[model samples]
Each structure stands twice: as structure tokens, then as C-alpha cells.
Target: MNLYVRSANGYRVASVDEVVSAAKRAINRKYRRGQAFTSPKVVEDYLRVKLSYEDNEKFVALWLDGRHRLIAYEELFQGTIDGTSVYPRVVVQKAIAHNAAAVIVAHPHPSGVAEPSAADENITRRLKQALELVDIRLLDHIVVGKQCVSLAARGLL
Candidate 1:
């Protein structure tokens, strides 16, 4: 389906798929640096652009410095449509390796439901505790699908 998108110039008609693709690319290019990711929306927009179109599940980590600036973003794990195995050890290792003071971890649900599964909660707990040991804070665990659910907002973090 197509929709009308309001651009700075005016409204333009385009397919929903094309609009999403364009938005993703634009967001990536525009917010690569300068913007310190200050809200969950930033992470959500980024993951939506980068991973929302995927067929399989992907777990990505956005490593941040002490000021919450982006250190790096990495797809740490991948799996089939159902679920992916996320190891806290690996996540912590990467945080230490990158000297990340905080992290925002996110994954997409191919099923288009952003609700956290029981497994999602369990892993979030494990990752939080693991990162604590390394002095890196777990800012949030966002589940991205048709919508983005911030576990931190729900006090899941």
C-alpha cells in the first residue's frame, strides 16, 4: 500500500515500502553522529530502519560512551524467525572491548509483535546483571516490530 508523506517541501505520494526504506536511509545518514541518543525513540527509529525489514530475528547492541554517545552498533546475534540465543558473556565482552559505559540492546520480532516474550525478560535480567559487573549500564532492551516496546519504560530493565 502507498501513503502520502509530508516532506519539508510538501506532501508526496509513495508506496509504504518505499517510504519506509527512504526514511531508514535518511535517518541513518542524518543521525550518524551529532545526535547523542537521548531517548528510546532514537534507538527505535534506528532499529526500524536497519532491522525492521528483515525476515529473521536479529539481536543488536548499541554501545554508548559515558555521555551516551554512540560507540558502535553491532548485530551480535542472528537466528530464525522464532528466536535468537543471546549470550550475556558475549555482550559484556563486547562492551568491555568497546569501552562502552552504557548499552541499548534491541531485537526485532519478525511476527510484527513488539511484546517481550518470557525468554526476552530472562535474558534482559541476565544481561543487566552481567553488564553491571563490568560497570556498564543497561539502558534499555527494546523489542522492535510493528511497534517498539522499551523494556526500560516498562521497568523491565
Candidate 2:
């Protein structure tokens, strides 16, 4: 399927990839380094743009500064349709490399539900402990799907 947008050109057509790419670029530009990372709405918008159409499981991390400003966003792991393995060691390594003071991690479910699994909670616990050793805060773990859920908001963190 394709999309058509009416502009000065009567009808301008765009592919899904083009639209998504444009959206991503717009998002990056709108949410620069100085933008606050404290809003759930903002985080959800960013995560949706990053993982909305993924079919396989993906793990991503957002490195933030002391004031929760964005430092880096990267995909750390990609897994099969059902699951991904996230290593705290690798997450800590990258956070240290980025000189991050805090982190927000997220993953999307191909199954279209944002509920955190037992495994998700377990990883969050392990990650929190690992990051604590280096003094980096684990701000939240967001599970994205048809809806986005924050483990922190649920008192899981």
C-alpha cells in the first residue's frame, strides 16, 4: 500500500519507507540533545518512531545526561520474533562509553502487547544493579506495542 498527500502538486505520493524516514528525521531534529527526556509522551513518540514497524524483537537504549537530556540512542540487540537477549555488561559498557548519567531502555513486542514479561522484570532488576555500580540511573524500561508501558511508572523500578 502507498500513501497520497495533497499538496500544491495536486496529489503527491509517498512510500511508507519514505514517510517513516521523514518522520524519523523530523523526530531527531525536533528532539535534539537539549530536549528534556522526562516526558512519557515524548519518550513514547520517540520509541514508536524507532520501533513501530519492527517484526522481530529489538532492544534499544537511550543514554541521557544528568538532567535527562538525550546523549545517544542505539539498538543494542535484535532477536527472533518472540525474544531478545539483553546483556547488562554490554549496556553498562556502552553507557560508560557515552558518559551517560542515566538510561531508558525499551523493546517492542511483535505480538502487539506492551505488557512486560517476567523475563523483562528480571532483566530490569539485573540492569539496575549493574548500572548502580557505576552510578548510572535506570530511568525506565518501556515496553512498546499498540501501547507503551513504563515499568518505572508501575513501581517496578
TM-score, cand. 2: 0.90
Report the number of backbone clashes for model 1. 0
Top candidate, metric TM-score: 2
Model 1: colliding residue pairs: none
Clashing pairs in 2: none
Q: Mind giving the per-residue lDDT tens digits that candidate 1 earns over 1-157?
A: 5578787999888776887788877877776643589777777878778777778998999888888888788899999998999999999999999889999999999999999999999999999999999899999999889998989999988
TM-scores, one per candidate:
0.85, 0.90
Clashes (backbone N, CA, C under 3 Å), per candidate, total 0, 0
Residue-level lDDT of model 2, residues 26-98, one tens digit each, is 9989887768877888899999988887899999999999999998888999999999999999999999999
Where's the lowest-lDDT run of ten residues in candidate 2?
Answer: 1-10
Q: Candidate 1: where is the Cα deviation over 4 Å?
A: 1-21
